[model samples]
Target: MEERVWTGWNPRLTTVFSVAKTSTSLQALEAELNSSIACEIEYASVYFFMPETCKKNIPVLVKTASTPYLVVYKSGIPVLNTPILCDTLTDNGDWIVIQRRTSGDVDFFKEWVH
Candidate 1:
């Protein structure tokens, strides 16, 4: 698999916040994200949401990487795919995920993006 590097806080939730894919409103997304931070799921870094919510509601911020990178985040999950893919995100330097190109699916980090 290929790799992409994000400098800093590549908020995956924020990146897709523009399209509003959640059953709840923007305020809800905000609340969900904020509340989830303390109540994170077993092995998940981010909660899952619909595509519309991700593209229309989340807000991505520009930050810096603490170290060099060879991967990016896949909606709070890490990826090891191509750098040109927009759906992929990157945090400090711990994990990586790969974006699915054909299906345009973002949920493959756990199943196939390895």
Candidate 2:
């Protein structure tokens, strides 16, 4: 058996990942992440408050600059097709840019992650 680590948390969500597994093949891990997202959409509704068909209508936003990973309901996405910046604060309190892939149906991912 392997150990799982809690990386981050949303108000009503918990993100658990295996430390040993994440560094090996990021693509495979991402596949696992997609599956986990799908599962959460299927079994849990405590966090997902949106309607089932809503995800299809929402646009997937990718990071355009190095910004904090804060979810803002009113922020506008960049007009260009750019990767989303996954921002994390530095030890000295600076924001660093992290790139991430946008996946899942907007409705499903939003409910599952938020």
Instruction: Write the residue-wise lDDT of candidate 2 on 1-114 in tens digits.
Output: 122233333322422345445556787888899999998875454224322111222333432355434222222355633323323344432232444449753443455547
Instruction: Report the C-alpha lDDT of model 1 over 1-114, residue by residue, as the tens digit.
Output: 123434343466566674555544777878889887757652253223212122322443432355332222344334633232232334422333334467765654485546
TM-score of each model, paired residue for residue: 0.15, 0.19
Native-vs-model 1 lDDT? 0.40
Segments in model 1 whose C-alpha atoms lie over 4 Å from true places? 1-24, 41-114
Model 1: number of backbone collisions: 27
TM-score, model 2 to reference: 0.19
True lDDT of residue 40, candidate 1: 66
Candidate 2 segments exceeding 4 Å error = 1-24, 45-114
